[model samples]
Target: MGERGRDRSRGRPLPLGWDEEAVPADLGASTSRPVPGPGGDGEAASAPASHGWSRLSRRSRRLIALGAVLVLVGGLLIALPRLLGAATGPEQVTREFLQAVVDGDLETVRAHTQDARGVSTAALTAEVLTGAEDRLDSFEIRHVAVEAGTATVTAALRTGTESREGTFTLTSSEVGAFSPTVWELAPVALPELQIDLTPGVQEIEIEGVTLPVEDLLMNREEHAPRIAVQLLPGTYDISVPQVTPWTEVPQRALEVPAAFEKSEISVHDLQLVLADDARAEVQRQADAMLEDCAASTSSIPEGCPFAAWGTQEDTPGTWTLTSSPRIESLPIAAFLWTLQGAGTAEFTPAGDAEPIEVPFTVSGTAAISGQGALQVSVPAEDSEHYGYCTDAENGYITGVVVLEEPGQDFSSECA
Candidate 1:
């Protein structure tokens, strides 16, 4: 300690706000001067100067230079490897998956998949083959992000190398988890459906989705996963009794013009079949209906009065099977048509009913039961003159009756 410093201290502590060594050299007078005090020894007294202040001190200068170099090197280091993960990137997996597919080695592809559902890639291959008619050719992996765990594989898919291009998005099961999985396509929406007064789905359309009808799979609702498709409508070649209710729907397979309005349609056709294995029950119902038909004559307003009931002989009748569900599933029902000598009785609308073109559905559904038009008709009349008459004198009776199950054969030619 210097003499002056000891005299000023007087045994108390001298405090400092900061480390003197860290202070900038320009922030104060050079540390080389001597301070003069009372009776001071005038001769300049010097202590050893730190080699850090001398340029000729190779050790200190080199140490500073080396420390600077270390800082630069540390700043440039990349931590990408630590953040992304240690696993292989999605691109490589996809590339290998494609190669395996080309080699027809599904087992290899399955091993590389990151399916979230833990679905076997081999199983996926089988499902695709079954659903797509087994026509797989090739796919090229365009990009893969390990962080995203998603790979975009752009490839020509076909039954052969001459395939077409289809964009597919295959992603891992979760975010930040690189588990590759197969692509799941969205449901091609059906149209806005107005289930008319007929029986089942009267009409359906995709609201904003303008998918072509040709691109749709036919008989969509027939199987497990229902698809929307426009079926060919016409008088089917098969017998009504031999067809499923879905197939038995009587639709005229003509392109519905966009200009056609609902009020412009006038007729609705329908098929009648047991909703399920309930044909026996429907037969009983038919018996009851017959009783009602016989009683409807003069007693009930809706009863059908055909004189001489009780299983009268089969009179001469022409019943062409339109998608016959069975020889006996003849869905030919009777609904009285309204007519007052054509135009003699001015038949004007009586209520708020407007006509419209429509496809129809009725009598249960295709799923749990069956699908088919149990009802179809021209646009309804809003008046009392042109409606279903149940009373023989003034009403149109429209109802359904099961004539037979799927086993009856009405194919016997008339003698």
Candidate 2:
């Protein structure tokens, strides 16, 4: 009956054990004890459970520690150089100033200057430092000696084919509590520009601003006028003003260097001459006018300086120019020009008689109209006359008449 009761108790549902105690398997030999219930007395109370760092994975803990170390290292790497630079001495400042000048850093150069009151960034150009930098292929500070708040730094400089040593002086000043001493450089003079003009040049102009010749000339000199002007560093467009009968000088733009004590520029003269294209155009118009004279059948065509005459009852003979027209003078002004040429005209009579050769001198003035066309004016004062055969009572008639001559007695010749 007892065995049956035990089996029946096992088969039945167990009661909830709120007061049970759980021990680790490694501590199985220890004494077994029952835990107090939720409403237990203070003597049997349970301690709160702990979730310490040992619960985290090993790799996760190691990664978090490495990230903190990397952050600290990166911050030091970024800030260490700036802290060291703030502690630079006067000699180091001078060396940095020279290096900045060579690199053409105008702002850094100006900042190191003793007095930058009137100096501007525009005035400190790369062109200004070109001469000095060109002379130095490479440079390094050799030695720096400081005494009584002043520092003298020696630099080893190299050129293309030469090596030299130079010294720079710096005056020390207090920057701030956290910063080291700063230095100021002495004032350096810019180069002078010498303008050498040609003998005929009387004046000079730069960028539309005219500079007086006397002001540019050197003082107490007996030679011809030459200018020596002190200029700040920059590029300038220079030219000579136009004098009468001479063309203006072409523009000459030059960059002035800061390191050079003296630089020279020579100016030349430009003269005006008649263009070949203009002369060729005038000659073409003169030849065209002479060709038109041969085609005219009037007693005297307006532009025809040489023409043949015939009787009224007979058909007019055709005239042909035997020689090419020549031009004597080219038109200088837009108004008028006189061209003179000599040509022969062949006149064919209406009958089967031989053609006669007439020698004539042609002179005419070419006027240019407002629309730029050539207007030929052949005056009557200087023209040739020729006699041609005309119909009369005689078996053959020859009449003499002056070409381009007004009110001539042609009736007597044909009678």
Candidate 3:
């Protein structure tokens, strides 16, 4: 075979017992004795990956590769450079397509694709190079050759979790450039990965960078001087940070926040109903919720905290005749950990037009030592649209409530 030799891995798994030249020399000889029992030599044994990998026994995985090799090794050398000539036909253009890839220039790579997708090669190049630094450990382009209008090349790449050895091929593109067609969207089965979570101290690893959990959680907005967590139904040991000491939470932990003592909780209602006056209808719903809160609690002027705080005016079925929209349903939560509640928000329109139905919830988690609860919820709308508590029971949001993603707030965005 005049095939170019592939570099063998340092360690390999070929059967040591098999004589390299014996099989062919004894091609027609019958050897094994018919054992009387159930088993013969049995099926071939598998060697661990660490030992070395073997080629797939199935024909499917090797079809494209085998065909490409057969055509190239025939000595009708359609050398890559000439195939990628400045004004070569599409078929001739297949040979040196992988050169652009080895050069790490996406613009040139995109131009070599068989189907340009109507997108500029420069744009395609930009997409491939984006976040590429985060994904690759090492990359090397070995050889480029073309058979017909397709190109094949050998490349070594290190994916973050593991090292993969495979051949890359270029699909013919309508443009002069050939694009790699490796993203066929197969159910890529990766090896199993496991991580253990510690209570107080968080472990963080971003690609090649690793940092502790405390550093990530540290923010002026949440200056958590101390944290205590409780992992329920206790089984695992609590490991606390020494300087920023940590402890594994058991089930429940009484959280004494950095700057606050008693954490307050409540939910706010924003409703919209169809009526003659859409604007008034929305105001009416807001007022009704506020009125109920005031009547229930004795901490408001005229027993109305909203009216006292001017969160909503103490309007009585007031009708403002204007062309505005009627909101459907809106609910938001406000939380305060150290005190009763946060301050207030100045009212603003959701958009240039009318408002739409939106659900809103905010919650917080506090850790006292090793125990902490992730609280989710329907929030109390007295002050801040902040996820400001660490109590699980009070903070956990369930049901029809809309809990925003960890770092987002619907209060202002949804208005």
Candidate 4:
């Protein structure tokens, strides 16, 4: 150390292994500079600057902008219609459903409905509904109300010349997590036509359109056949096709109310009127059968009501129909007209000079069962109204036999 406290290490031995060469050459001068990197330059090497947008070519940038625009447009296209539909709300949905029915758009109608309870939906077809002459003419929406998640739409439907007001119920549901709500009509029990018909009836004409009964048959309730037809608000004329020589039902008009107004139409019994000629035809058939039976040579004609015997064993009685059977009334039961009448047959024994008149009552059915043709059977001997005339030798015909001959005693004819 120097006396004045100045370091004299330059001329004297450095203390504690200090090396003057390792020290900076110009340590007292002030200087600032970056440390050298592995490349040995005074400043660190840097890679080229990379900006994503700047890296793309000009045309590529234009294409990217167009793609973004298309995505935005596609999103809007998908959302716009849903937004518009939502704006119209349930009232519009109700109107659309009714319009679909009138348009005969079955797919749309099914989509809008929740549950359609009808035994037979055959008449609900687009073709059938469109072809119906009594189909709905038009509809007008009167009012709309919203409550909770449900909606009520009041409307009037015009069918033919008649108009009726009714209410429709609807409920809303979300289509998807991102989609707008969808409205659907609530459960609608379609109107039913309960028609009372003869069991064998095959077809019926409604509004001048013929439909098979088997296709329209929905159910049988209270022993009456019920046909379920999805009818619009309209008046329909229904008639059974002519069952020839037996029964026919004239066209009857039925007014079907709205779906929610009245769900059922109990069309009164299809009162079958006996055809004017049917009665005469049945009568003629009965008389012909009786006459044919009387023509037999045997004492008791095969199916005839009378039997006569001669005193001798070798002789048989000759029989002839004195009075043809007359049909008093033809009452139908189970598709058959039961005949009630009486007839007379004269029988002459071979030895007797005079003929004995035998009176017989007739009772049986005129059946058309399945084949559309008529068949009459009026056998007095086998039927409930059996009457036979015989002498004491023939066994008694049981169950209150009556003698129509004023002078003849009952014991002689019955016993």
Candidate 5:
């Protein structure tokens, strides 16, 4: 039995359980195997592997191909929208910027600009937005075009009854991960205020501050003076001194817009005729002067109207002003004025003598005194007649006195 066992160990094979075929399959062998193809060589010798693949059902093959195709298409779908968004980011930012401006969202607008230094958001909202919104009826974004981190946006703006198109330009830059692309706006310059005045406006006052006309007249364009001034956004009360005696202009109120680059204000229409009360007051003072002159016992009383005449001796005749004085020139002030006028005076000789008529021109200053009394004064000139005359010769009154009444001429008898 030992010889037979030794022979079996040496020569005879064991059962299938202990044979090499019984070893477990290697996990890597299937993957490491060469793929089969039509090329002739060792690679073609591996063509038998294709037979196993061919054994699969047609439906299974189609499912595998479709899954592969879906993977490729899904990857592109995930990446495409992000790329498109980056490309159009500037345009989106521009649209948002304009929307903020129109809505008066000043904070948001400031956030979108890099050059917002010294810009007041409150001023923008209060002055620019308020004024624009009051006039704007509608607003719409027309188009947005983006290129190379810069964008231009066009919009249609309807203000009052007018419709206009406008444009805004914006730039973009990378901010951070959360906001990869941030946009900004260019700096805007402050605005100017241009004032156009009437021919005789000597000076202007704004907010109790006087502005000289000569200074504003510098850099004049043609004969028309340029009154342009640089000012911050605000409301202003402007006043111009009187230019003519017959008219008084009122103060002008103006509101400067925050967004205005340049604006014009014209003061041509502000002139108005002198008030009736002022005109009547002046006429009354002149009439009182004439009456005082007629009642004065001296040839020329101190406050008399004809005191401007250089007569010395007391004339033995009753004097009367024959015509209403015509005011030729007047210098206006806040509460005083200098007035000049012409009239005729008649002197009747004491002993039934013919009356003599004299023409005269007089100038006097009138004012409201402390006691609410209107005081008038005629300033005397050297070698000229004024006040009570002590002595006079070369200052003779020479003009003819032609007195025309409603129905008769009193100077006709003298002629």
Candidate 6:
């Protein structure tokens, strides 16, 4: 058979079940086979990759691949509609526009609207819109119509319990032959607002933004300024900030309707009225001054509104207040506030003289001296012959009474 077979036969005997003569002669012979090489010549090949992959049948691998493809296609089918809905449609754009208004997204709303001439964007801010009451709460697309390159979308808008139908017009244009259609909202014209404010207010606060009257006035130096502004449909708060500790103007919150009617908003005589606390403080100070005057025993009290003048030379008298003076009226002026009140004062001259009771009125001027403190000035007694006029309605006394030579017609001198 072969030299290796003859060597194995001479060395050992075959097993019991193995037949030596029946065995093939080429059983132990060595042989060589051709293997592919990089150059495609006959050479030994490198070992193959893992046998696990090689053990898989072609049909099994193809089946697994087909299953994976089906899974991917099913997922795409589920998500395709949502992705398409987000990208293209005029109805989608209309919905987005309404949603942006509800969200107070000024940028998005401006992006959707077409450019208009003379559009005022000063009040077109998210903060202003957000501060408004009865703003757009929700919306639903009711109808959509497309004809030629023009489209109209009607939406049901709701604010609070009020519902209204708002229609939007859109125009589509092809940018180029190969480009897709582009849609934009048509220009909308809204109403204008004309505001007339009072004189004392120099500045106003609307939706957190401070507006000065000088800037808003048609004529820069006008006493009572007017502000003309165009804003989106919303309610706004207009108020004057606290300019002084003694006075304030009431806050006004007005709503600018969505209708196209020209509206005029006027707020006149918003006077710098005295605050409650300031009035109370003024009354307290005035009361204290009168109390000190009543406690004085002299015939003429210095720096006091009331005095017991024309008394006998050697007679001492005491002035007592029967009714305390209260601040009945306070009138405000540029730098001073006038205070007036009416009360009864009793003056009793020495031992045997009867007490004289007079319905006396006091008038004084108060001003803010420094650090918000009040400085009050009242008339005191002096030697003179003068006529005093009494304003019963205003509780003010205007006069000059001079004793020409002590008790020279004291009653005739006062009027």
Per-model lDDT: 0.30, 0.52, 0.30, 0.62, 0.52, 0.61
Candidate 4 vs candidate 5: the TM-score winner is 4
Q: What residue runs in model 3 are displaced by over 4 Å at the alpha carbon?
A: 1-99, 114-132, 135-154, 159-162, 169-415
Can you write out model 4's per-residue Cα lDDT over 8-99, one digit (the tens) per residue? Answer: 44433232222212333355642222457777766754423443444455587778889999999989977876787676687887787788
Question: What does candidate 5's lDDT look like per residue over 1-415, in tens digits?
Answer: 6586555432333334322232224433432345555664547344354456454555777788889999998877766655655754655665565565556566775564433232222323334345332333456778878799778777775544456565667787765433446666544333454565543345676665656655555335433444655443445666666533434556776655433233444444333234455566667766776776777665555645564244446755578778867653243332344668888887765776676777777676554332234445543122221121111343311121212233343233222
Candidate with better TM-score, 4 vs 6: 4
Tens-digit lDDT string for candidate 2 (90-122): 566666766765566766765644432322223
lDDT of 1: 0.30
Which parts of model 5 have CA positions greater than 4 angstroms off? Answer: 1-25, 28-134, 142-154, 164-169, 176-178, 187-260, 266-276, 286-415
lDDT of 6 by residue, 1-415 (tens): 5676555543343434322223234556422223589898768874354434434555776687789999998878656654554365678777877777778887876665443333334566766777778777788889989999888988887776367777888888766543456677775444455565543345666776776655555534334455655555567786766655766555777666543223444555433556777678767877888888888776677777766665754346888889877774343432245677888888898688888776778776555432344445553224323323334564333333333465465454334
TM-score list, all predictions = 0.25, 0.30, 0.20, 0.51, 0.39, 0.44
lDDT of 5 at 303: 49
Question: What local lDDT score does residue 52 receive in model 5, on the 0 to 100 scale?
Answer: 65
Q: What's the distance in Å from true for residue 102, model 1?
A: 3.8
Worst 10 residues of 6 by lDDT: 15-24
Best by lDDT: 4
Candidate 3 residue 42 C-alpha distance from true site, Å? 90
Instruction: Give the runs in model 1 whose Cα sits over 4 Å from its true position.
Output: 1-56, 72-76, 79-94, 100-135, 141-153, 168-415
Best model number under TM-score: 4
Q: What is the lDDT of residue 28 in candidate 1?
A: 47
